[model samples]
Each structure stands twice: as structure tokens, then as C-alpha cells.
Target: MKLQQLLSFTRKAVDEYQMIETGDKIAVGISGGKDSLTLLYALSGLRRFYPKPFELTAVTVDLGYEKFHTEKIDALCRELGVPYHVIKTDIAHILFEERKESNPCSLCAKMRKGALNEAVKKLGYNKVAYAHHKDDIVETMILSLIFEGRFHSFSPKSYLDRMGLTVIRPMMFVNEADVIGFQRKYDLPVEKSRCPVDGLTKRQYAKELIHQLELDHPGAKQRMFTAILNGRIEGWPVRLTREEVKSSS
Candidate 1:
């Protein structure tokens, strides 16, 4: 997708969920990947003319990997005129060398988010923007169902009361395919992940499963996303009509 298309989808999610407010400072969690970089581009574009004025900062928690560098990301942030911060941590060593975890994605994610949240708080940002998109939402719901025997997916907006932080996924309406297209079209500086278990996780399985389902049954992904929107899942934002959105804006 182009930048304009990305902004439209992002603004839709933000408006529907009321994610941003006047004078709100949001930290975009940058992982140097396509999804995160696409989010940075979307929010940077949205910040220019969205009715509600807000501030944005790009943040990444470096997991102490030798090959994982942020030079390109820093340059991109500079190009976008957003402040960039990298929190250095020994999470890589802890997960791979010391613990040798067979299934490290869960622990790695927790450690990464814990570090990211703390940095965001210290940076005085009240909200954090995650890059989870439509595919991620459906895949997560499928993962929950197949693994935990439940039908659940994360809300577009969630409050972490204990940490005093609000997490918002602004690209909830953007598809993963569109993200890839945006990255390629814009020449996004994507830093490849060096993690050993990058694509061997259950989430990867769910993603592939969804891809196959979509191939067999056209529009399956859209149906699942629609179901999630209408399922009345706990913490989901109430759907707003086009009239309501116009009046509110």
C-alpha cells in the first residue's frame, strides 16, 4: 500500500478506538522490521494532519544481539523528524546463552516489552503504538483457539493499569500483504532479525494456516476479521457508525 492508504487505515483505527487525544505523546515501538517500520511511517504521516494533535517518538529495545543494529532505523527516524531511542539490554544472552530456552519467543517477547514499556514510561509517553495488523489479529485468535481452547484476540486499544501505559494498535485494519507492499514501495530500511527461532514458533504456524485457509476459501481472512469485530470480544472498542465518526471529528 502507499503512504496515503496506510494513513487512511491507521486513522480509521485511531478514530474508531479513540486511541489518540490532544497533546498525547505516543511511543512507536520500533523493531526494525517491516511491520514496525510501516507503523512508523503511518503514524508519522498521520501526525501531520490528524485533527487531534499528538507527538510521536520511535523506540526500540535492543536485545543485545551482535548482528542486530539500528543505524538505518536511526537514520529513518531522523528523516521522519521523530526522536529515536534504543534501550540496550542483555535479553539475547539471557534467552539463548544462559537459559537456552527451547521455546523462547514468549519469554523474549515479555522481556522485550517489559524493557520497552519501562523506557516509554521514562521517556514520559503515555501511549505506545504496536504494529499488530489485521493478519496478526486473526492469527492470534486462531492461535488462542487451537492452543488454549478459547476464542480471543487483543483489543485495538488496551490499558496496562499496573504500568500506567496504554497500548494501541493503529494498523489493525491494514493487511500483512499491504504492509509488505508498503515496505517495498517505500524502500523501507528493514533490519533482519537475527534470532535463531524467528519463524519456528506457533504463531508462524498459525500464520501459515491462515494463508492456506485463505487460498482454499477465498476471503476467509476477511471473514475471521469481521467475526472478531462483531464477536463482542472483551475490551474491543465499540463500533462507530460513519455519521458518529464525522460528528466526533
Candidate 2:
């Protein structure tokens, strides 16, 4: 995907949700991964030309993985002149040792989120932005439906209780494929996850299924997004309005 396309996509999501405004202090969550790195770079680029007043600082939650590296992330932020914070927490050890669970992706994610929330509160940021994209939302929706019998997915903009900070997904409209493409185009720094049983998790299975469907039928994934935004609720595990149901039916 071209940089111009990414600009328009990111602008739309931010504009629609009013995520950035005059004098807003936003914290971009950086995990030293492709997604977060791309997000930080995009936001930084937008800042130069954006007609509003907003400040962004990079923040990372270090889970104390044995092979994980924060140096690269630090160098990027430093090069960009963005202030960053490294939260030192031994989440990986807790997930592996205490839990003793073979696959701890879900728990590990929750712990990371909790750490992020706490960090936001401590740092006094008005908004916290994550790198969750369209694919992550789709996979999460499916996972929630199958496992919890719930219709829940992360919103582009929402309020957190403990942190009392607005959580925003500036990349909500971005596709994972596009992100991967951007990574290739821009050559952003990325680190491999140190989680040993990473692909064994159920979410990985969901991701593979979604990937296969996207290959089998082009526009199938886009239609799924359109269906959700268009208010069709059959595919989702949630209550639906009569109008939405009739419109789809």
C-alpha cells in the first residue's frame, strides 16, 4: 500500500472518532513490533502536517522476555525525538512459571493490557492508542463468540475506568495486510516475539482460518467489515435491531 493511502485511512479513523484534538496528550503504545512501530511512525508523520495541536509520546511495556530487545525501539523513538518510557515488568515469567500453562497468549495479553493501563494512569496521558487493526478485531470477535458466547470487540475509541484515559485505535481501519505491506515499504524495525508457544494458541488458529478465507474469496473480509458497520448482526453474536436484520435479510 502507498503512503498516501495510509494517510487517508489513518485520517478517516482519527477524524471520525475525534481522537486527536487541540492540546491533547496522547500516548502511543509501542511493543517493538511491526504494528506498533508502524503506528508510532505514522502518527509522528501526521503530526508534521496535521492542523491540530496534539502531542504524542512513545510508551512500551517490557514483559521481561528473555530474547526481547527494547534497544531498537528506544533508538527509533530517540531518533524521532519522541519521549518514551519503558515499563519493567516480569510478565513473561509470571505467565510461564506461575501459570505453568502451556499456551499463555490470552493471559499474557491481558497482563500486558493491564500494565499499559496502569502506565497511562501514572504518566497522566489523556489518551492511549494501541496498534490493533481490522484483522485483530475480526479475529477477536470470532474468538469471543466461540469461547465466551459474547459479542464483544475492541472499539476504535473508548474510555478506560482505572486509567480514566480514552483508548483510541487510530489504525482500526487499517488492514493487517496493508500494515505488513507498509512494513516492507518503509522497512520499520521489528522484533520477533519470544513466546515459545506462540502459534499454538487458539487465536492463531482463528487467524489462519481468516487468512484462508481471505484468499479463497476476495472481498470476503471487506464484506465482513461492511456488514458490521452496515449494522448487519447475524454473523455477530449480539442482539440486533429489527431494521438491521430486515435490511440484511
Residue-wise C-alpha lDDT for candidate 1, range 104-208, written one tens digit per residue: 999999999999999999999999999999999999999999999988999999999989999999999999999999999999999999898999999999999
lDDT of each: 0.95, 0.80
**TM-score against truth, every candidate:** 0.99, 0.88
Q: Tell me the spans in candidate 1 whose CA falls farther than 4 Å from its real position.
A: none
Which ten residues in a row are the worst by lDDT in model 2?
Answer: 231-240
